[model samples]
Target: MRITWWGHATTTIEANGTRLLTDPVLTSRIAHLRRRRGPAPLPEAGECDAVLISHMHADHLHLTSLPLVAPDAALVVPRGAAKLIHADSGPAFSDRCIEVAPGNQVRIGSLDITTVTANHDGRRLPWSGHSGPAVGYRVEGAPSVWFAGDTDLYDELAAEAGPVDLALVPVGGWGPSLGPGHLDAVRAAEAVRRVRAKIAVPVHFGTFWPIGMDWVKPELFLPPGDKFKAAVDPEVRVELLEPGESIEVLA
Candidate 1:
């Protein structure tokens, strides 16, 4: 399977001749924050057979980037998301949105995707005018991959996700300190160990940040991913990709 990190929580996974996009936040600027790094590859949502909405957070479920995918692509979103997507972004999303909850499965062409529970608040910021459930995905095909969308360490995660070839785990956020229901590099490394994935990719770091706060402590934005990789068990290989970079893994 081929995996590409597109900054923040967004990723593109290709397996079984099908492309799956996860939490696509392709815009250069989202609300008050401007992407400090170069934008992700042009036309960010490219030829995806399905798109996974991990949660309703703007950084994860940016509606602006949704249209980049093919209109026919199936959208695998959390339960109660359809209404919220329509209410927040309008009815244009109704055509292909498929609402799913933990343990639910959806098939897109040759791939079978199963939703998994996430230990995080799923509600979209009421002020943002969007809301939806939070969840993760376990995709099975030529190469099974687990995308643990923005979640903290939870006891049931190892048993729920099972073994997979690759795991995409979030290690940081766009803030100086992580709050309840979020994972720091140490916690994310522990989560990777629990899942027992053959290969792990650290994401959700080194992306957008609040303007004018760069002086407070810039290391917070750049080092968490590498720190996580260094702390994790060496048995599992780790790949840290810059935005727009791709990695191929054989399980």
Candidate 2:
């Protein structure tokens, strides 16, 4: 299996001849955030059989970058989140969306993508009124992959996902404080242990930063990848890739 980290939470999972892209923020900037480390995702990043969106956060559920997916690629998003996008992206755009909550599963060619619960709130906006749980994905194929979209550690996490070969974990965010429902390097390391994954690749860190706050808690930006790697158990292999880099794993 080949996995490419496109900076932040965006990653391309290639296995069993099927490709999946997650939470693609393909542009340099989103809202008040700017890409600080990696280059913009190459065109090949958008070429996927399906697109996995973890939640409704602008960075994870980037509306503008949604069109970058292959024409026929499935857009898998949290339930209720699709409606928020269709209103702005046109009704026709909704045709490609496959909304899911935890425990739901969808087949994409040679892989079976199942949604697992994430402990984050996925509401589109403060007053938007849409509601649904955030989610992660478990891709069952040659090299089983667990894409832990955006979530803090939960008790049933490992039991629900029935993990396989590789795990893509979110170790940090763009801002200084991670707040309530997020994982820092220490917690992310614990999560890797919970999932019992053989290989772990840290994502959602060392990439984007707030527009003018580059000097504030700068360690929260790029050092997370390094920290997560150091925190993980030595028994489990950690493949920490820079944004835009790919690693091939034999599962």
Candidate 3:
């Protein structure tokens, strides 16, 4: 299986003759957030068999980026996403969107995706009236990969994920300080141990940042990946990749 980090939570996973994209943030700017590192996601990031959106957060599920996905690509989003993803402002993805709650499974090409719980708020906007449970995806293919979209460490994480060959975990956020419902380097390492993954990749770090804050806590912008790698148990291999970097793994 092959995985490429497209910056932040956006990633491309190629396995079992299928190409899947996760939480794609294709724009160079999203409100106050800007693509401070790595190149903006290219058009090919949208060239996939399916797209998995983890939550309703603008960064994770940009309404504008929805159209980038090939019209035929399956879109797996949280149950309450239709209203937000298909807002009247633009084209509707209602036809391609597959709403799912935790434990629900959907098939797209060679991948069987199972939704799992994530510890984070799933609201799109303060008054958007769209809300749902946050989730992670356990993609079963040639090499099972668990894409834990923005989440904190929860006790049932390992059990919910089942056996994973590669764990794509979030070790940091876009800001200097991560509030509740987020993972830091230490917690991310703990997650690696809990999931019992043979290999792990630290994501959601060194990517986007609040505009004008680049000079602040500069290290926070990109060091978390390495920090998480350093904290992980030696038994598990941690492959830390920069934005647009790729790695190949076997089940």
- Number of the predicted model whose TM-score against the real structure is largest: 2
TM-score for all predictions?
A: 0.95, 0.97, 0.96
Candidate 1 local lDDT, 104-144, one digit each (tens): 99998778899998998898885755555689999986568
State model 2's lDDT.
0.87
- Higher-TM-score candidate of 1 and 2: 2
Pairs in steric clash, model 2: none
lDDT score of residue 44 within candidate 2: 89
Residue 165 error for model 2, in Å?
1.9
Residue pairs clashing, model 3:
none
lDDT (C-alpha) at residue 119 in model 1: 91
Sort all candidates by TM-score, best to worst.
2, 3, 1
- Residues 48-133, model 3: lDDT tens digits: 98899999988898877877778788888899887666664334577678899999999988788999999999887766788999
Q: Residue 88 lDDT in model 1?
A: 61
User: lDDT at 230 for candidate 3?
Assistant: 84
Q: Model 1, stretches more than 4 Å misplaced? A: 128-132
63: Cα error in model 3, Å: 1.3
